[model samples]
Target: MKKMNKAEIQLLHNSIQAEAIEAMQKISEADSVWRCAYEKAPDELPPQEETEKLALLHHDFMTALTLLAVLEKTMPRNSTRESLLILSYEMFKLTCPNTFERFGCEDILKSVATLLDSIPTPEMLTAGSIDKSVHMIAKAAQYLPKIPIVPKEETPTAATVTVAKDKGKEVNINVGLHAAFAPIVPRLTVFDLSVMQAAASIYASGSKTFSTNQLYRVLTGADAHTRITSKATLEAVRKSLDTLQATIITIDAEQQAALGKYRRYDWNETTFKGYLLPMTKIETAYYSGNQLTAKCDCWRIIDTPPLLAYSKTIKQVATIPQKVKRLPRGVSATVNNICIRDTLLYYIQLNRDKGAKLNYSTLFEAAGVDTSDRISRHRMRKAVKALLQHWQEIGFIADQTDVIESSKNDTIYIS
Candidate 1:
């Protein structure tokens, strides 16, 4: 009587299982009533006591199952829940010291039955009643000197789970107790712990054959919104799981090849796509503006010869000869230089708008030089080179592409 022997524990374990199974069946029937009502006249269905009773039944069944699992570890194989009832009754009659010492109960069957009857039926399952029941459970361990041992050391091994390829990757397919009970592992509830044990058994098999969608379905729980909050965290997790970069190698071969051709050059995609192929440089272009300015690298014109010529004409028209003679020598020299540069800039501007390749003759013609002037092509080429070199220094035209080669007769084409 000092301790309930293995036989007595087995009998108690079986009794609890039988009672739990019966309660579960009754709970199922109660659920069916609401389901039928929902299907037939859902709009007219009212909240009722039967529904409440069903909930309580389910709650009690879960509690009983957890206890039975604990007892099973200590009990014999052949003992049934009915046998447990008989044995407890007999033990109580004999005043068994073991039963009283361990459970601190002289009547185990009577105590268990009393506890089961205390469970609230659906009608009586108010918030307060539920709270009371939960409190009773928290204190129930006091009824026994030693709490039932629930195995925590046992874990599912890799061999038990069956993994299969899902989009060419392995996944867990374990169906053991530990895996099943994973949801409740973090809780203080005994039912949760029991589920954890069950899951451990199933988890042994490992991952199963599941596509990305199916895997999501299996792992996703009801409360996803409460778990994932920030966009950054979600994005980071997604990137870690994604196989897109590896897959892209096979999918975008043509793009890769095209990119490889220009990989050595210092051009990015935008330049290649828009202007790389049509890039060019021009050599001998006449400027016909007042100030002889050169165009820069970005295809901008600075000065031309025509403008210079116009300014000179304006000066001659506005100033008298006496006033001009009164001016200093330095001032006159400066005026002359300005006139020349402006004339050259004007001529360049005139040709810039046209598609023609301008040379000295073109400049002379645009400037309206007389036929008797008889300008040599050689002298005109020198003038053009000076203008291009000036522009080159300012980076209007890159020096590397705008070289004035005397060997090519000083004629220029955009490089």
Candidate 2:
């Protein structure tokens, strides 16, 4: 290995630093993204454009770290070695936070410092130099010195649902507005809900049956670039409509539709006026998906199933804005949006107490996923945090609207 004095050491460090100059330039972009998100509201997340930029920032950070993890074997150790190690560790910690936290960083860093000590003058450290620390962090995180979790005393509350120690056990769903429609049908998604909401909007205009075009327009905002539907957006609309029109709500949605079927029949000559209200099943809908004439492709919502079950039409619910239709994919994400929208509407339906904290189970019920048991408590906790962050990003909810997952009560306070 070649030895170096102060001039040689500084020259090498500068050259290496020049190689990763992009990281130096873009590393701090996360702060700007964070500011943009929090500027409007603490819960706000970046809009689509900013979201793309955030991805680019992370990509740059990862790219830089990939290049910097190793020391060229031919270069001898000098005073700058610790600086190199510290730079790599700091960048790894910031860019790979989940990995960092999972590894339990402090112990991992110490172990890394120890390992580097024995390696002698740079025989070329591999990428594993950082990964070695990652491995140590992972082990430290997995089997950390155990600290027993003392259970908090259970407190009596007015929440109507039963409270039992979860014990990491999946129990039958135990919360909802009615036993009939307990869980949201499994296949149903935001696409389905968006279609249903749009159809509900049309109900007032005396449109007994709505065309597919109406749904497409509402869902896609008549693209400023062109009026013709994009293939992807049209396909989404087709699937959503097909999903709703498919004579049977899948068992998953049926549980959610259970709430839909439970609505009492109101026969007012003044309102429904002898119009048949079919109740064999809560959203007993059927329609033609075959491309007939563009004008002829339409749907009859069989019966107005609970379009998210707030005892009001979609128009009556707190509007979440059509912009959210562009929100990224995932069934859970779609459900999260509905749950937040329902929180606003839920209070009105029952005249909920202002101070009462809404429990996680009830949110699951509102999302129509109460009985699905697909989403776990940990994921729900993450969803809550993301939900709040997005709200803060968009200024959708108040700053004071905080969550209470800190206790056994696992609840949300939507002020």
Candidate 3:
């Protein structure tokens, strides 16, 4: 095919988008007709012949949308990621959707996936396609999860990946080439997730409220070597508590009223989630330990005059899941070099003691890997293989000597 100029590309884009909307309308009409015909029937499934037609229509719709994603990625944009994140927010405002729905991040995944090419090889997927997106994306991602999210650890992360092409195939070239952090401020972590779980689990133990030290013991099993001693780690625990508390995720009317009764801290907005929104304003709190020296013990020693301390002591924001095992006492300032999707898989399957087989499709979608087309799916599979290999190498998962099958919709044994 000959190279098409920008105008030609734009025309093609408009054409495909029209086709996609037309297909979507046809599907809707067909479904309405089928449902009306079967309104009295108990089951909603269409007849086999109708099913086949619906499938074809769905395919056409998706193909057009996916093509649009690929084409839009090539269009020139004036904004630079090097510019201020706030300024990028301005550009995003000019182009992004005017209004956002409360639930479902589907639009974002498609847009970002469009922003990143759905290539034939894994090479591009792992590379820094997400780099420029971070400045804009982080600004927007913080607002996406205002509602309850399953396995909150699955929150989007921006981790740079670089895969080497191997003799007509892609291989585990570079999984962690940059520090990984989700766009949310206060910097939630796998460890913080466990602490939340700990707080939730302890409610069953008849504790109305829990202390950071209590969570610390549960996380590290009270091992003297791993005891929580450093302020860095202590702050991590504190931040997680404060963040979860401020978000008010539990959704009780009583707690809703008490939101600003006590001073609150505003979380900085930045994220790997698919959308963009400016961060909420900070509600300042007065606390003495804000700048404690490395060896300060003011937190441990309650003041004689009785201080109204700005502490991270959480008061039951959520319930529990399995807490992370063998957590480190102090957190390293160095950013974790891991894939965002890998982080999700690891955190959710962290305690799958007995290995389980998960379909590649399920993992692919959850990890936010693109699988819109055959080429994208092919690249996604290779990326998953590389990810699994990294897991085994890092001892996060047991060795998977059994390789992922080249066939589409392969299942992998995750341990």
Candidate 4:
């Protein structure tokens, strides 16, 4: 054994630190790449699947790689990298030998060590040099002595499904694959009611028979996106009902309208129909001809967290626009627009209180306005159209004139 001088030790430390720096940079880059691949690329992979597990695995691998690199850099160059690499390999061998087979190699280990050894070291007599040296040497010594290789756990063989026809029976009822291969049918999240509703509705509509995959896609759809839970496909489906149950806060027409603006299309009757109706599972619906009819039983979607948490964040945002002078006073102005805007707001408030089933006369009475004046009715109609146009402009209203007309009073219900 040879003892090195202070200068030689310092040179070794600098080299090792360089190696650590390189390893950290590479691991970070790899982490980002894996994330992008997981999130952005849909190539040949299931869209509805959650890639979180793979992401976490990638993260852990990178983290371990980083720690090893740092340990190598801080330790002496002679055997520091080799020892860390050995420890990593041994750990993988114990826990996941098959996974280690994919990426673990002598060259990679050696390179990792070399990279850690290349970082620049501070001049001697700086803060805590002796402590750092002692720590590095101790760490290197600790890992160098033993390299563990974990015994492989026996993986269960794939379960087989058998189908046999009952003797002397004309009919053959379908049997579940899980019934035959119970152990292999990976545990799924509990079934969710909302997902059940969506599935039931889909099934009723006579769309092709539902599969776990199709259901997954539907749950991932815009209407059900927030309701999905769990990483396992089956488990996520099972949890769909619970997620839907929790979604008590119904998404209002305004939010629906906001969601619609992201997609472009002509204002046709079909799309208008979709915008007017609430989701299919609702028990009953009513007719409203002119004014928008919002369902009062609108369900909740997300859990309402404390307002203060959000309010502080909002306050932090710059409010310079609020201080800006009104649109140069004459950019736009009209009595019809103003009156109609006020009227719409009035009607909205009244409808909110009165429920979606309110008739035009009832609404007018609620607003303290006369329902009989022909001229007033004409003005109101014009105002309604203008309000619709404004809602359209701001992407805050879907098809505004989707009126379910009332036969008794010849009034329109804006659904």
Candidate 5:
């Protein structure tokens, strides 16, 4: 790949800025529509007729924000482009305070600004450098709001099981196991999850190594179901892994405790403290034909502390009759879009037995979502609906009678 010229880079930056401006304008318009629809009640859902429009507006805003985040990386340090990017970010916050609050964008914006201020100007960015940063930013953008503030709670000592009704049949949902105890890590996109799953599978099979092509097949679902023949898709998956490795996740104090007994520490506590990537390391090899030949020494779960705790927690609950459903290839492809995939999986894992009743508000609280916010509620509803649809498509829930029952009082029962 060739390096991007200054002109080309500036063009990209301008395009991103234009999109950001448009997103801010649309958000302002949407606020007016929202007020008209809900009489200034930000906590109330818009009428059914206007819901789709509102959702589209939200989507546009997020897409633009994502692009803007990428542009942050492409610009030179202390340049006019950087100043404009900062202005756009501040404008979004000022124009859409509620939106920012709902999505928890304040800390992220502050951190990005700090990072921009510290970066020294680079003479020239290579193609590899630009691609890697773009990939990392794109992946990071999807997960910004998903990180939950850890609550004060004692470490769990035993599994807690609850019973619920599904079609008048009794079902068991375990709440006190390692699955529920695992510390919250950075929210992972579907591709990230798929890569982790692939690594887990490889580790489970008594192997510590896999090729990039092998991972590509697993991610696209071709390895488990269909045959993946397209080189383009494979190349895309390879690129995604490169991006995935660049993404970092921070672990909390509780999470650190969970892993303290397992691994010996070598990195610095202050600078490297609590910060780790999902994959410990990834290396790819290319051929003379510019094709990816192999990937080696990719480590996860066992290698990463937080993942180790999470994996251990899952194992502790292995005795549960109905295990957490695995994502099928078709479902895995779009899992990133469902912002609450982790929460949804937790619900399913705990309530997979017959006649399971899950409280909607409780699940939302567990997922660190504020149900009081109308937009957050709306996103949760859509995420749950998408999760169920995907579960059925992947045959995780085969019976048409197995439905999610929602009450007017905000409770969800799984039957």
Candidate 6:
């Protein structure tokens, strides 16, 4: 498509702003409709008979927002587009204050303002202007809600559970990659990390794609013994996927190879930054009149050297004794808990046959814990204690009577 000129861009911006204002006005009018239909104010809960109408209105509003976002994508990256985004932000602030806060519009506004400031005037525009324009566009796009259009009367499929045998199954994660980049990028919640691991595992199994339900099952570890049939869990997984998609990770030349080589080696450093799961696509499908199905293509991980290296390391470590390589069953129920397990396993593997007593701080850092925060320090201490207990249980350590010493300086010693 041809890039939009200044005039065309401004016209489009004005059109979208006017449409948004009209929509807000219509929504306000809908409040009166609700009052008449249900004999209740907009702030009050509707009667059962009007609930469907209210739901339909909500769905329509969401669809409108999505369309507005789609429209924003068509415009050229310039002051005009930025102005439209700002106008949209203001409209949301007025019409849907709760939605604005929930979607983090404040941060989006700040980011857009920063990008706009960085852009030079047309007369002073250099080759770098094109790059800055692209950056500004992407930064603005991040704030747009990528919410799937939920169909009414959709029923989710039964969650699928795939349990690998504990004897041979091993999780290989790049301790170095996560330690280096996670603190710098937006910090993923424990559940988000779990979803990422699940996706990684699916990719490692030679599958390029997996469904959101598959992710939820892997995350919940639902089995015959433990059934995790929670709608909330599925919703949480979806939300985490949204957050992961919006998160942008930047890698300079220095950190590129250290983290991993990109699949697209010819990235325009002026415009491009490292994104987790770059080039991957997410598709939502509705099949055979079933619930909306979301799937992620993780082919990008294959090209990522860090992930590949981590997977290779995992396979190699799997050959070691279970006492050293595997965490005890039930220890890794969550992402943070699993981090502790993997950290200890890596530490033990690093010190194998050397009998070196690695420092607690080093292990904690290697485990991907952020030690800069006091709460994180406390968490690390607890993780260390848990690891010690698990080691004793697995006979990796001598016994409960074995004396693991700690110095006054807070360094732990493992004999």
| Ranked by lDDT, top first | 5, 6, 2, 3, 4, 1
Model 4: lowest-lDDT 10 consecutive positions: 127-136
Best of the two (1, 5) by lDDT: 5
- lDDT tens digits, residue span 254-307, model 3: 222233432244312111121111011111211222243121111110011000
Displacement of the residue 396 alpha carbon in candidate 5, Å: 4.9
Evaluate residue 279 in candidate 3 and report its C-alpha lDDT on the 0 to 100 scale.
16
CA deviation > 4 Å runs, candidate 3? 1-192, 220-225, 229-231, 250-324, 327-412
Using TM-score, give the best candidate's number. Answer: 6
lDDT, candidate 6, 311-371, per-residue tens = 2422322223323323334344444555555545444545555544656566655455567
Clashes of each: 89, 23, 7, 39, 4, 0
lDDT of 1 at 209: 13
For all candidates in order, the CA lDDT equals: 0.31, 0.39, 0.36, 0.32, 0.42, 0.41
Candidates ranked by TM-score = 6, 5, 2, 3, 1, 4
Model 4, residue 331: distance off in Å is: 79
Candidate 1 off by > 4 Å: 74-415
Q: Which parts of model 2 have CA positions greater than 4 angstroms off?
A: 1-194, 202-356, 370-377, 392-395
Off by over 4 Å in 6: 1-198, 212-225, 228-275, 278-306, 309-335, 359-383, 391-415
Candidate 3 Cα lDDT to native: 0.36
Please estimate how well model 6 matches the true structure, expressed as its whole-model Cα lDDT: 0.41
Q: Per-prediction TM-score, please?
A: 0.20, 0.32, 0.26, 0.18, 0.33, 0.34
Expressed as tens digits, the lDDT of each residue in 396-415 for candidate 4 is 33454344455576354443
Error of 6 at 114 (Å): 47
Question: Model 2, residue 16: displacement in angstroms?
Answer: 71
Q: Flag regions of model 4 displaced more than 4 Å.
A: 1-15, 18-22, 25-34, 37-99, 112-415
Q: Please give, for residues 180-273, the per-residue lDDT of candidate 1 as tens digits.
A: 2112222122222111111111111121111112111111110212222234422322332221111100011122223433234332221111
Which run of 10 residues does model 3 get worst, by summed lDDT? 301-310
